[model samples]
Target: MNNFLAHTFTKKAFEQLASIRNQYSVSIYLPMYKKGKELNEGLGQSNLKSCLKKVHAVLVEYGYDKSSVNDYLKPIRNLIFELSFWRNPSEGLAIFLDKDKGMRCYKLPFPFEIKTYVADHFYLFPLLPLFHNNGIYYLLELSRDYVKLYKGSRNNFRDIPIKKIIPKQLEEVVGFDFEQKMLQYRTGHMMYPAGSFHGQGEGKEDEKKELLSFFRKINRGVTKMISDKKAPLILACTDELYPVYKKINSYHKLWDTNLSGDPEFKGTNELHKASWSLIQYYFETKKREKLAKFISKFHTSLTTCQLSEIIPAAVKGKIDTLFVQQKEDVFGTYNSAKGCLILDSYKEMRNISLLNMAAINTFLQGGNVYFLEAEEMPVKNIPMNALLRF
Candidate 1:
């Protein structure tokens, strides 16, 4: 498996998910087993077909041309029979399609709710979890002789085999004299100094400059791979090299905290354990800050927890921030064209989720969304709410 699960969550990926056009669109999400399991057991494929079937039924009821409906679903039908696509799986898979024949697929490191949407625009809320709390991040372990890249989240991580931007050791890149020159450069201040070449010996400064030059080359190589990424890059290196690497790093999302040891000596699980705490803390801080903003605007018309009020505003693209209870699905249907919301009990809507639709609309319009616990919301215990832009 040559980087079978190799993927990066980048700003461009999110933009594609958020893009909207006035035409028939399809979004499908399903959990997938990654390893040591049977493939294409029919569960995921059947779910996708069922979602398309519902879309066809709706199109027929509304008097769409039979050929147009079939044309709209052709990409989906093609996907169902693609057995090769199922063999190389991850934790989940998400597929998007449109009437223009554009399609995109993502093999996720985490599982997503098994849901589907067929509408005027693709439903994006299901994919938001990848960017929201506890989502994906990167860990880059750097040293003079070795470098390793990993992509994962708080709970799990996987190595991204380094093929580009390979870092070489001092001896390998320069010569054995590199370390001797480095030591003399640092301790040249000794009273009984061994003859300084330039009296004040700018050799140490030259050694430092050389190392910085090497680091700069490495940074350029790493940038090509992760420059478009939004996830934080947590760096790992020796204590002395940290300052040097930081000065040369151009990746703006590099985390403030980092591992202070030789990361190459650490295992994947060890690295994940050390890295997750910082990632969790960063997300929690962001959530707290957003909650404070919401509370400050609670009495204003800008914030609301009313479902009836939020549904229309969401459809109209007025939501600036939304806080919804995690893993709690609300059943209903939303007609974006009419701004109509018909709520039914969870048991009644079958696979349709109105809460997800509202969130999806909000995200498509470039709104920030937080999937928070009930207590973390401005209005505690409320299942759904939003901080409106208007």
Candidate 2:
């Protein structure tokens, strides 16, 4: 079971799946429920069974003999009744199969539209959010008494243990003898405990200095914990603490915007919601900036919205960025020898998805790929667009 199924989906896995080209590649996507009656009642397993049925039908329609089709789908069929496999499901399940690669399944974090595709290549546009820039980040819940670290993506968040590497509380680093009065309040509105002396201007400055020292230690620990230094780190703290932390933060990718408010009062889900909102804006801004660049170069040789031009450019590693319309498929075959693209209204035996090919090539060659709504495309009504490297 562990050999066939994967819980974590990475860009490397996506690239491997995309690189496969076969005569009877099978891609299946099923929306899964993590909780509720649907989970307990085996609805996910049932849904998978239905999807497998579709896959079997599609294989038959392609003229594979009954025995060959059954043998090809046997791996998936074994999973239909595997109760344990369905019990711990993610928001979606993606399965890819071919004669050469056997079968690989991923329980992905994002919900997917239920569909299946049997073609020369796997359908992968549904997994783009995980690969998008700003899609993954770290959220540091910073406070004097409590500290936590979370690794977050566009739709998932999980705690990353920092207790061993970092001090869990400011007292651990600054010692218990530091001014108790200063520690009582983080914001201007925070009330001093009854009978505690409320200090004047100098005390506030001292508090800042103490916090700066504590944050410096935290910054060191956080830097050590983060394997990807370029990934953004969002600070979750009150407005007052943000400036003090900023003064001490050594991380280059700390987000300019802090997750404002007292993080102590927020649950993990609340923190995820707030942080994802900020990251989404960051992602949108980047996409818009790219779109603006595309528009500026619209009439030049550096940019193009034509599928014929984009497909070959991608194959040759000439695209800097490729924009594809969401929920749309352009099936075709590309002749590398002739530098030609032939579009088909329907999927055929020899044709693959041109948009998928362009995206995969661009991504594999270190270019960016963005899936946008029809209205958000650089050129309206164009299904695909590209910014060329040369």
Candidate 3:
């Protein structure tokens, strides 16, 4: 009741809408928030009857027919009918069709509100623990990319993500904020805790299932949207979970790497040292060509923390990728963070400047980190290892 279902259309529709935008020689100026927009009666030709009919056909074809759509679409439908009256395209009437859906019309002039699903194609998922503090008092590490992050004040929700990116690759590349359909990771959603190492407590099947199902559904839906549309996949999890998460998705869980519950790793101090060595190995062997090829090259793999640390080393700047049961903070140059680089640091590394390389930075760098799975964080678990090639 709080939010509407049709609101979901905002995300997909905006993406589809853009495909047809250039046809009108018009540029869309989306808002960062709900600033009250001006509703243009028609975004198509006056003689839009033919267009409406075609759109209707598409709606019927797509699954929105009778089963999915509602009984009332008065305003939206009439807006389509009004299109047929326009004569020229200059009146800004054309390029109005986006995927030909059952709901052809919408609450027009949707001011560019950045929160939730208000932006043309922007969506936000709140913060999740990815890594934790390394000291006695454990605190989670938080990181985000392609998002508008606004830090809340005292007593306010800290690390709350207000916007999530679900736009087309083209829009994302050009820096377009399209807040459309918004989703959240709810409680009992299958997550491995902030820094969980055990899968389900001794008697937590029901609890685990509830959480797992949620994560699975989201993962399935999200991966598809991201893969097909080449959209950005924003993840917020625990630092310990990241390595295990990566291993499950890709990477060989080699016993030789000594990630098992070994007796030697009975404490945090030992585990952090081991994990640090593993990371050091990767950084030491990193290659410039492999990373440089994608530096600002415009590609999809750029979003995941999978390639998180590579670029940080490339710039030879300070980068804190996260180590041990608790999250550790590292300070370094901010240049690459502007784009084609890594995370931001508190202490500017002696060899680097935290200067903005541009204005945008990559989402995977570890300084501002989070967890993905718990096993990767063992008392002596060195779960993740960065890969480097000659």
Q: Choose the strongest candidate by lDDT.
A: 2
Model 1 deviation from native, Cα RMSD in Å: 7.4
Candidate 2 local lDDT, 294-319, one digit each (tens) = 99998999999888788889989999
Ranking by lDDT: 2, 1, 3
Off by over 4 Å in 3: 1-202, 227-234, 240-390
How many times do residue backbones clash in model 3?
59
Against the hidden reference, what TM-scores do the models get? 0.64, 0.85, 0.18
lDDT of 1 by residue, 1-390 (tens): 111123445556666556666455667777766554335366766777787787677666555678777866676678777777767667777777764546677787778887766556666666676666676678888876677788867545887765645464544456677777657545744333221223344664565567777778777767777734788888877766777788889988888877878888988778898888768877666667767888898889999998878888888899988888877767677676776677777522123566767787787788877887666667876678788898
Predicted structure 3, TM vs. truth? 0.18
Better of 1 and 2 by TM-score: 2
lDDT of each: 0.70, 0.82, 0.28
Q: Write the per-residue lDDT of candidate 3 for residues 1-390, one digit (tens) a residue.
A: 111212112324443543332211111112211212222433232224444444344444443456533232233345444433232221121122222232332222222221111111111111112112211111112111221111211111123232343221212322333112111222434354433446645323533343343334333333433322321122223344344434433112211233333222234333334444433333322223223432433234332123245444424423323221222222243345464434454422122222211100211222322232444432233322222221
Q: Which one wins on TM-score?
A: 2
Ranking by TM-score: 2, 1, 3
Worst 10 residues of 1 by lDDT: 190-199
RMSD of 2: 3.7
Model 2: how far residue 24 lies from native, Å:
2.0
Error of 3 at 19 (Å): 21
lDDT for model 1, please: 0.70
